[model samples]
Target: MLQHLLRLSYPTPADHLDPEDHFSTALGTIFSDDLANQHGDRDALITYLPSTYPAYPAVELRLADPAGEDERRKFAHYLWNAGVLMAELWWLGREEEHKWRVKGHAVLELGAGVGLAGIMSVLAGAEEVVISDYPAPEILQNLRSNVERNVPSQLRPKVRVEGHTWGDVTSPFPAANAGKFSRILAADCLWMPHEHANLARSMRHFLSPDEDARVLVIAGFHTGRARMAAFFDVVGDEGLEVEEMFEMDAEGKRREWRSERDGGAEDHGERKKWLVLARLKRKTSINSGSA
Candidate 1:
């Protein structure tokens, strides 16, 4: 197990120390072993055990062949968004303020791909989780296979898989589901500036009416800052407000992207990868009585 951990580029310091040093060390060992011998002909199984929720079983997923031409170009199997999603889940488990967002709430994940975020939500005790992606037959099949393989039989009833295209507010998700989801998730779906409007429209249509309802969005810097900024602009124009945002590097170092207090200077270029996470809520309007 330790050898597999080394091969996977895990932090070296974690290996030498005892599990008592940190909970994640023990969890990482378990996952390293599970994934060591799982890579097969067309798929690979990756495992994750969030340190915050030790009681919950490690999340195991069988990823489709990324070498497929359509799969590679469509960005369906990349690991960037999944990494950020896992970190956010760990953070939520420890933070009292945001922990309740998943438990007993109606959750929706857009561009679900292999359904990592949505699957994690179910493990976190979400009342219901809806996973959606493009209507391509191969994509939907791969996604359904993943949910069936990972989610336990008992919990499978709480999950729903569907085909959805961004910007189309009518199909797949019916009128009855509108304003029903308390938490919506979008990961690594902001690379295309052209699709920003459609993404926002879907969020606006489905997000719950409660003021506290939120949409959790994350994306990597691989697409560049300009595209990310454009996505923010479109969402705002579509009536969503950013409540919090931050950037995290490969080492788990986080810096406030838009906060009252400045996050100290650091060289972002040195990091091979960086992710930005944001929480958004519907923009509220107030009507004033005539004076």
Candidate 2:
């Protein structure tokens, strides 16, 4: 089954707008002792997941000057983990040749918090990749820096990184990006309860006209299954389809751990990750046989 990731804010009888969507800083915030403990035991400089060979160096997403450095670090750290985990799973699916079938094609990524998917696409052989975020100038600046900092000069292809708000249509895309791109990738971008409409609109804009254009998305369960249903409804209304899905093990970790408490502690609904391969539907040509 195709699972819906990050559907925590789908509409109900009385759904109110979430201020975080509008007023939250470009670098969001989070503070949890559990996350901090995880960071401390490991090298804060860089780390890579075990599965990906010739492993890519890790990058941390940090909150920009929040009330306290401690609080800001938590949010930034988890955001990076989300991106890394998503990329790792996608790469695992394509490990047969250690390259992507969509290589050498134009690519675009939305809501790229730490640029993991875009970076991975380049590593997998994209001709040119554009990393886009919200219009917030500062946040966009950070995204650009990460693309440059983390992307090794040798492996980096012709890449352009920039920020674009969800609803803005006039923003400039790469010349080849006018209607090109064999692949479109995103992860953990659907969580904003209040921004589903805006997100749907943006996906339609950046999505390619080729009905077979490849799109691989991995999203975690944010607000449980109800919220996910709403996101799927939005996607269906916009003419996209979810092709496949996977779920993580208990404790929100990507892999299973052998521990006694895990036996009955798992909530089947919240432990899954939705991996979707979707594409935009092409409009019928007036002279086509079907038409």
Candidate 3:
């Protein structure tokens, strides 16, 4: 018998919503520790059953060793804190004034490793959702499988999985998706300082020109807050402004975003617990880039 990942477990109820869709974010996570997780990965077809989401089905991920610097590293193997934070925020999303959600919006998830945010967006009743990542065959295949199995069938039409390399304007992805996404979600994607400009350019490319359009970002402190700051520098260069930014711990304690703590006294444990969540919008004012 073959293990087929199916959406049979996630059914649409008569109320036009899911049973646990609007459950609650007060608890921060569905599963205990690391925001709840599942497991499975091994041989033949060597299909991986990487169960990152507690509420969703396992995705089939096949790892391929790359030759160039383009494939130097891969972060899709595990579900990080920032990814979990975004998912939990969108779970119920009633804790704050600016609730994390995608209802009635065209959502585009950048660097969608394992497609967690976009998958949750579909459950949150988004108008449409496009889950994207590097134009890697193995990665894109896994994204498609996850979307097919985790998202409700009726809403599958509203979701698209595409191969998108950040800032690659020379390619067709940018032109096709330009100004189409009302809400762009990026989680744990600001780590590489070298890629900040490219990432920012991609955000500008897909982000809708509408006043209400915004980019939702959540990055962990594990990689150093300085890298996060560098990403914002590029965001400004790309005509984007930080509407709001804050840090929240795994235990759900919210705080204002600030400079990184001293490196010498840094606590790896504490760093693992903190995540910076921010909202970015296009700078529309005449003197938008003055800062």
lDDT of 2 by residue, 226-276 (tens): 454456556655445554343453133334222122454545433333222
Q: Any residue pairs clashing in model 2, and if so which?
A: 7-227, 7-228, 8-223, 61-76, 247-272, 247-273
Task: State the displacement of the C-alpha of residue 17, model 1, in Å, after optimal TM-score superposition.
Answer: 34
Ranking by lDDT: 3, 1, 2
Off by over 4 Å in 1: 1-42, 65-72, 81-88, 92-100, 258-272, 286-291
Clash numbers, per candidate: 0, 6, 0
Q: What tens digits encode model 1's per-residue C-alpha lDDT throughout 71-162?
A: 56666653444333443455543564463368888999898766777887887789999988877777777778878877889999999888
Cα lDDT over the full model 2: 0.49
By TM-score, how accurate is candidate 2? 0.62
The C-alpha stretches of model 2 lying farther than 4 A from their native spots are: 1-46, 55-81, 90-102, 154-157, 174-178, 246-291
User: How big is the positional error of residue 237 in model 3, measured in Å on the Cα after superposition?
Assistant: 0.7
RMSD, one per candidate, in order: 9.0, 11.5, 10.1
lDDT of each: 0.66, 0.49, 0.68
TM-score, per-candidate, Cα-based: 0.75, 0.62, 0.75
Deviating ranges (above 4 Å) for candidate 3: 1-72, 90-99, 286-291
